[model samples]
Target: MSFRLYWPLIVLLLVIPVIILVWQWRRRGRNVVMPFDHGQEGTGFWLRLLLNSAASLPALVLAVVILILSGPTRLKEPEVKRKLTNIEFCVDVSGSMTATMGEGDRYDASMQAIDEFLEARQGDAFGLTFFGNSVMHWVPITTDASAIRQSPPFMRPGRLPSQSFGGTEIGRALLACRKRLIDTESGDRMILLVSDGMSADLGGGRDIEVANKLKGDNIIVYAIHISTGEVPDAIINITSLTGGEAFAAGDVEGLKSIFASIDGMQQAEMERTAADAVDYYQPFAIVGLSLVGLSLVCSLGLRYTPW
Candidate 1:
């Protein structure tokens, strides 16, 4: 609530009103030569003081006006807002994803976990990409969760087209997701990869290449393997390189827990915006208006007269 002036030097003009008010208070009374024989009495002390005060009202109003013209300002309160994060879900729709895990298959568990994740993260932008032998962008990066919520049934592994989409290409899917994430010009970028098996394409140094590219573009990769087997080394490498972790979830509950862990690890950031400067003329304006009203009232009787 501190006050500041845009043009501080203009405050020097206050000297004019100060001098006028001081002179009005300090000047002595003059004698009036009346035609009629009246007593040689002077104005009473309280009456003289009241007259000086009434005369000083205009000077006080002028001072307030000067202050308003100086452009007074105060800092507005700071605001807290959630920092946006763009998350792309790269889910494998290969044939192996149809294998059973808990009550449903790996694909079902993954989709359910994703639904829960979307519910937990209400303010983030999400994109959905189904990857097998090829990649399909089912949903674009957006704040709307309805599209992502209604997407699982359509991209189920069993419902995907013939054997053309049977192979798992983790590196290719990651690269595709990275392309979509990089196009987004704002927010923290992340890729959540869900798969049940290893990809032949990610072996040797292809995983490193993809990881470096994602890292260069500031995209983090969090991998979730919904299988009893260990998570692939390539997946671990990519996630680790991009400042993320890989988790293996054997059942539906573990898959949900894994998504929750990812949520905990990549929590939404809180940002505090700098306070803005706003005009602070209300007090001065009120004072000026009051003085104006007082001056108008005093004009009827308390003003100085030549008589």
Candidate 2:
């Protein structure tokens, strides 16, 4: 811990000792003041030391009072306030995801994994987006997790397969997710894309463009492909461009494991920052007050007297 003062000019009070010495000499009409020798034997060594300490009480009190007036403070070490990671869950709600791959359909199983992912990364901020032929924001990027918890039921598979939420359009979905992450002011950004099929929207190097956009913004993409056959090369390129990975989750258990892997990756990117210091002055003020009290008590019986 370190000490500091707000009003350092108050320490000028140390000049009190010089002023008192000068006044005492002037009042006695002496150029060189000498200690009064009573001619009797001096008191014992311990007694003389005790008497000298009593005479010094006023000076000690003055110094303490100066410190009190200066508003002294004790500073504590810097603290790490937050280690934040902003993650956007980009899940595919295409009709293909309705295929049963585990205890439930791929979509349902992925939703459950997403819920567990949120729980595992407790302190990080999260967003939720669902994509197919079109993209939709299920939850904005935020520290609150309640919105993510309620998303599975609202956007579950087999609701109503339409062009807006029924076909896998990876490029368009990634672009939309990137836009959302761009609007975020701070923190490490990530996109967790879950899809079970390839997309026409990824043709004509559109996928490459999306990947570069994500990489430029420092947005990592982690894709979980839940289909039976080999995962798409386009998906792998999109994820790896931004220092992320693509995984093929054949069943519910594989999907859960992929989510756990993403959790670890996000945590690995977490960073800590210094927090503001709290003001601490009460103890120093108390000590100064105690010195004043001691000075008053000493004055009652230990002060010098002209005999």
TM-scores of the candidates in the order shown: 0.77, 0.79
Model 2, C-alpha of 109: deviation from truth (Å): 1.1
lDDT by residue (51-170, candidate 2, tens digit) is 556666566666666665555555456655556778998888878888987778988888889889888888888999998887889899999989988878888767856857777788
Tens-digit per-residue lDDT, 261-302, candidate 1: 999999999999899999998999999999999999999999
Name the 10 consecutive residues with the lowest summed lDDT in model 1. Answer: 1-10
**Poorest 10 consecutive residues of model 2 by lDDT?**
24-33
lDDT by candidate, in order shown: 0.89, 0.78
Q: How large is the C-alpha RMSD of every model relative to the true structure?
A: 4.3, 4.8
Best candidate, TM-score: 2
User: Model 2 Cα RMSD, Å?
Assistant: 4.8
